[model samples]
Target: MIKTLIIDEETVNVLSYASIKPLWFTDYQIPLSLEQRIKRVQISDKLFLISEKTTSESKLLVIKVNSNGIFSELDNKDKSIAFDRVITIALSQFGESISPGKGWGRYVSGKKLSIYATKRTQKNKNRLYFDTSPIDTNHIFAYALDSNNNGFENIEVDESLFLDSVTLIDEAINSSWQNTVEADDKTQYGIELTEDLYRSFGECLNFEQWYENKLTNEQRSFVDKSYDEPVRLKGAAGTGKTLALAVKILKDAYRFETEKKQKRLLFVTHSFVTAQLVEDMLNSMDSEMNWKFLEHVKIKIVSLYDLAQELLNYNLKKFTPISKDGKEGRKLQFEILEEVLTKKLLEAKFKVGVLGKCGDNFKSAMESKESRKPLLLEILNEFACVLDAENIVMGSDNGDKYLTSSRENWQMHLPTEHERRAVLELHMGFRKYLKDLNVLSMDQMIADLNRYLMSHEWNHICEDEGYDGVFVDELHCFTRPERMVFHELFRLNKSFETKKLPLFMAYDIKQSVDDNFICTVKKGSGSALINSTNVGKTNLVELTQVFRYTPEIAKFLSDLDGSFPALDLASEWSELTLKTNTPSGAIPKLSLYSDPVDLIDNVFKLASRQARSLSGKKTVAILCSNFDLFEEYLIAGRIKKYYEPISSRDDVTKLGRLKGKCIFSMPEYVAGLQFDMVYLINLDKVEVDEDNPSCGAYRRFVSRVYLGASRAKEELHISACESRQGYSPILQPALSSNSLLMS
Candidate 1:
C-alpha cells in the first residue's frame, strides 16, 4: 500500500484529499518559499522514495505525519474506511498486544484513531500507543516500530526497516503534535469542524461537487476597499451582503490584531438571534484563528436592542427591557395596546350612536371585538414609528409638532389628522401604562438611548469608549431611531462631528419586512440612514451574485420582485439585481390543498420525503405565515416525531439541540437562518388583494413570502389551502412566468 504521499505547498493547497482512496499521509506544513524540487524514486507500486532538493545540500528527511491531523479533510465514508483499515492492520500484525479485552474490536470500530508515544521510563519502554480518544495520553500497546535515534537522518535501509522507520517517524510526529492538538481542542476545533461539514453539505446539496468560497470581483472590491465615510452594501436576498460584512469584519479584526492595534468594532443586528448567527458565522469563516484574541481588540457583536440596554445600564437608567420570550412578548404588547385603547375609548365616552372625530370606521373597529386586533396593530405601528420615534409626547409641544408635521409614512395607517390625534391619545395611554409598570418597549428603548447619547455627558463618555468602526446587518429592517443611534455610538472625530465613523451597512430594500423601515438612499430624504452623499463619497457596492441559492430560485425571486408593486416603486430609488452562481435547481412548487387539514398533511409528507432524500442530515424549515397556523401545528400529532419548534427567543444552544430535526417557525424568527429545504405553509393567511397591492398589508405579505421563500438554499415548497375564491393573487407573477410548479 502506498501509505505515504509527499507534496509541496502549492500542490497541498489544491489537493482533493478525499479522492485518494488508499490510506496515505502528506505534510501540509511545507513552506511555499522553499521551492524544493521533488523526485519520486519508485521502489514498488506501494513504496517510493521522494527525494527533496535543498539549497544548502540535499539530504533525506523522512517525516511521517500523523494521519489524524488530516482526518477531518476526508469525507465521512473515507474516514470510516481509513479507520477500519488501520485497526485491521494493527490486529493482524500484533494480535492481542493491540486488543485490550474481549469487546475491544467492536469498541474501537467506527471510532477515530489517535496515536501517542511514551518516553522510556524505568517501568516503560520507548513504544508507540494507540486509542480512540484523542485526548487520552496513555493507551494499550498496538505495535512498536523500533528506532535507535529520535529523529530522521540521511540513511539507506531495507524495505522492512524503511517501513518501521516510517512508523517510528509517525510516532515521533504524533508525540510533538499532541500539544498542538490540545491547544486546538481548547479553541473548539471539533465544533468548528462540524460546522464546516454542515456548510459543505449545504454547498453540495444541489451540485455534485463542492465549490470554493472564492468571492466575486465585486464582493472582493467591497470587502478589501478602505473607506473613511460610511459604505452601504445593497443586494437582494442571497446576494452575499451579509457574507461581505462578515468577511470585512474578519479581515479588519485580523489586520488590527497583526498590527497590535486595539480597535473597537461593533456588529449591530436587529435581534439577538441574528447577532448570535453572525457570531457563529465569523467563527466558522476562519476556524483556525483564535477568536479569543479579538476580545482584546474589542470586537463586539450585539443587537440594536442589546446595545440600547447596555447604554441604559451604563448610564444607570433603571428600566426593564421588553420580554423576548418568543411570541409571548408580542402577544403581551398587543394585549397592553388593547387595554390602553379601550381605556382611551371609555374616557372619550364614545358610544355606538355618538362617534368621536376619529370617524365611523375607527369607532366601529373599536366597538367590534373581532376588528379590534387589526386596529390595535395599526395603532401600535403608528405609535411606535411616528410618536415614539420622533419623541412626541402627547399633550405637549412635541405632540403639536407631530400633529402639524407631514405624515408621509403614516398615510397608510393613519391618514387623517383626526385619526392621528386618536392614535396619539392611545400612544399616551400606552406610555403611561408602561411607565407605571417600569417596562420599556423596543421603540421607546431605542429612542431613550438615542436621547441619552445626544447629551453632552454621553458625548464625553463616547469619546473615550466608543467604537472605531460599526457594521450593521439587515439595515433595511432598522427603524429611523435605531439607525440614528449608530452616529453617536462611534468615536467622535472633531473634523466630522455631524458625520459618522467608518460605518458599513448591508441592506436589501426588498427584504425590509417592517412597514416603518426607511428604504430610500436619496440625499436629504430623511428616510435612509446612509444618504447619496455618503454613498457617493465612500462606496455603495451593489452585489449581484446570489450564491446562497440556485439560479432557479433566483429567477423566481427576481420574477416576484418585478411583479410586486411596492418593490417596483422601491426600484426607482434602489436597484435589486439577482445573478446566481449556483447550478440549476428544481423549480419552486406551489401546492394548493383542499383545506387546512389536507395542507398540513401534504406539508409533512413532502418535508419527510425531502428529509429522507438528504439522508436525514440536512435541515428543513416549515414556516407559517400566521400565528394561528403556527400554534395549530404545534399540537399536530404527526409533527412531534419530525419537527421542532424554533422560537425567535431561542439562542444558539437551543438551535444546536434541533440540529438535524426539521424546524417549525415563522419567517421573522428565521430571518438570518438558512435551510436545505423550506416549506412555507399558509400562504393564504398572508392575505393580499390585487386591487390593493401597494397597501401596507400587501407590502408586508410580499415581504413575508419573499423572506420565507429565500430561506430555502436548495428547494422551496409553498403550500396554501384553496378557498372558494381560489389561490392568493401574490402567486400570480410566479405562476404566470412558470417560475413556480403547480403540484
Candidate 2:
C-alpha cells in the first residue's frame, strides 16, 4: 500500500498538484559525517532547518514552504550542495496520537520535532466543518520521533507511542498527590475522592503512558490498598474497577502474608472459574505494586466456593459427616458455605448418594436442595446439638425507622425470604472465613470490642491469627438477604467495640443501580436509622474522572444515541480521540446473510468451538440470552463446520484442550464468573420475557444486561447482528465507525 519516490539526480519541478489539498510531505536531506552538527539555513521568510544526528538517524534539513517550489529549484548553489545526499523519505511516522477536534486537544511532540509547536488552539465552532476540512495546523510543525530520533525504534506499525509523553505523566503524578488524596476535596482535574488513602499517584502509572494514556488521580485513588468492610464498585465498560480490585487483592495479600503474618485475606467471587481467574490476576503484574522489594510474603488463592467445596469434598471422600466416619469422637463436619450456590459439591454428592438411596430410585439427598436439608438436619441433630440460632439480623435502632422512605404500609415487603436467605448465608460465611483465616477464636472475634457485638462466644477461639482484612467484592451483586447477615456482624462489632473491625469497606455503588439492587426492609426494621450524630449525613466518595476511554471514544460514549450515560460522569483524562465524523457503523462482524437459516448455521459452529475447555485446564462457558438463541447459533450453517453444539458434556475432556486459551458454552445459569479473556457472540436478540419480574428473567436471563458485560478482562469481543451504533446502552465508549471486521 505504500510507495516511495527516489531523487537520484533531481531537478524538482512538481508544484501545485492536488487542488483539494494544496500540499503533501516532501523531504530533503544531506548525508553528514557522524561528528558533524548542522549548518543552519533559512528558506524564504518562514522555514529554517538543519541536519543533525539528534533524532536517531542523521539526515538532511527539512523545509516547509507556503509558496510553490520544490527541492531541486532551491537556487543552483543550495541544490548543488545536496549532491552527497543518499536517500530521502516522505513518511507519516505514526505521527498522530492526538485528534485535534476531540475536546481540548493538545499535540505531544517528540525530540525530533522538539522545537516545533503545533496548533496552539482551535476555536470550538471551527470543528463544525472539521470532517470535510483540512487540518488546522496553524502553519506550524507538530510532532517528532524522539529527542534523539531513536524513540520509536522498535515500535510496531500499529503500536507506536511517544516516549517523552511518559515524562509528562510522571510530572503530573508528582504534582497532584499532595492535593488529591481525600474523600471530599475537589481537584483541578475535577476528580473527587471517595476515600482518604494516598499512594504516589505517579507510582500507579501503567504501560498506557507511552500510548498517551494514564489513570487519573480519581481512578488511581479508587485502587485503594484495602477496604474496611464489604464494598461495591460501579463503572462503565471501560472503567478500571476490575483492575483496581486486582491491585487491592495483591496489596491486601502482601500485607497479610508479610506484615501481619497471622491474618489472611479472602478474595471472594461467585464461581470456581472466576475464583481461578482472580487467582490468575492476583499473579498478574498489576497486583505486584511494589515488586522490587516485595519479599517474605506467603499466600494461597482459591474461590470461597472452591475452598469450602474442597473441604467438604475432603470430608466426603476421606471420611463421613456422620459419626460412623469419625475416630476421635466423631468430628462430624458440616459447612455453612459462604457461597451463593453449591453446584460442584452437590454434583459430586449427587452421584455418590444416588447408589440406591432406598428401594427403586432415590436421588442423593445432598443432590436435591429439597431433600438435603431434612437429611442434613437429621445428621446434625444426632451429632451437633442445636445450641444457638444461625445467622445475624442487622438493621437499625431508635424509633420510627423503616427500610423504605414511606412507612405507609408496615406489612409491605421489600425482600422475600428467598433474597434475604442468600444474603444471610454469604454474610455468615464471610465472617466464618475471616475467623478461620485469622486463626481467631470465638473470644478473639470480640477481643477488641469497644462497642460492636460480633462475639458469639467470649473465650479464646484461636491460639493464632487470621487475615488482615476481608475483601467482599461485587457487593452490589449480592441479594438483600446477604446484607441482613452483614448487619448482624457489624452491629455486633459496633456493640462489642471490636478493634479488629475492618478499617473500612470499599464499594462502587454505581453498579448497584443497574443491578436493580435497592436497600429495603420491613417497617421499623432499623433500616432507616443511623448514627445519631451522622444521622442526616451519609459519607461517600465520588470519582469524577474516568481514565478508561480516549477523549474521542469518551465523547462518542457520552453522545452515542443517548444510550450511554457518558456526560452524567466526567473523565479526568481522555484515552481516545474521536477520529470519525459520526459513528454509523463499526460492529465486529459475524455476518449471516440469506434468511435466518444463515444465523442458525453460525450458532452451531459457535457451540462446537466452545466444547473444548471443560477439561482440568479451566471452566469455559458459551453465553446467549435464551436457549433457542443458543440452539440457533450452534446450528449456524457456516460456522457449524467447526463446532458440535450441545448442552450436556459426556465427558468435559472429550473436546480436547488448549494451552493458555480456555472457553466454555452454557446457558445464563452457567455464565456466572470470569475468564482470562471472554468473547461474547450471537447476541443480536433482545426481547422482554414476561415471567420473572424480579429481573430474574430479564435480558440477561442469568446475568443482568449490566452484569454479564462486566465479566471479562483486557478483551471483549462481541459478535452481534446489530451495528456498533445499534449497540447503544449495552456498550460504552462506542466502537469507532472505522471498525474492524470479525467473522
Best by lDDT: 1
Worst 10 residues of 2 by lDDT: 125-134
Backbone clashes in each candidate structure, one number apiece?
0, 81
> Candidate 1 regions off by >4 Å?
1-213, 288-291, 294-296, 314-318, 323-332, 342-355, 365-378, 400-417, 498-500, 518-529, 532-538, 567-576, 609-615, 635-642, 651-653
Tens digits of lDDT, candidate 2, 1-743:
10111110111101101011111123222212211322222222322222221222211122222232222223333322112111111111111100111111212222111211112233211100000101321111122221122322332211011122211222322231111122223312221111101111223333233113444454445554334433334444445554565565565555555664544444544333333334434433443324322444434344332232232332123221111101101111224331313533444332343222332212344346643533332222211111111212224231112222332232212233322332233333434553453322121121222112234342222112223344444444333332222333222234324333342223333333222122222233332212111112232333434443233333433333222222112331122222222223223333423333444445434434453443323323344444455655555556544433323211121122222223334432222234323445544434333343233223233233333333432233445554322222233324444232334
List the candidates' TM-scores in order. Answer: 0.67, 0.38
Q: lDDT score of model 1?
A: 0.57
Error of 2 at 92 (Å): 54
> How does candidate 2 fare on TM-score?
0.38
What are the lDDT figures for the candidates, one per model? Answer: 0.57, 0.30
Tell me the lDDT of candidate 2: 0.30
Question: Residue 245 lDDT in model 2?
Answer: 58
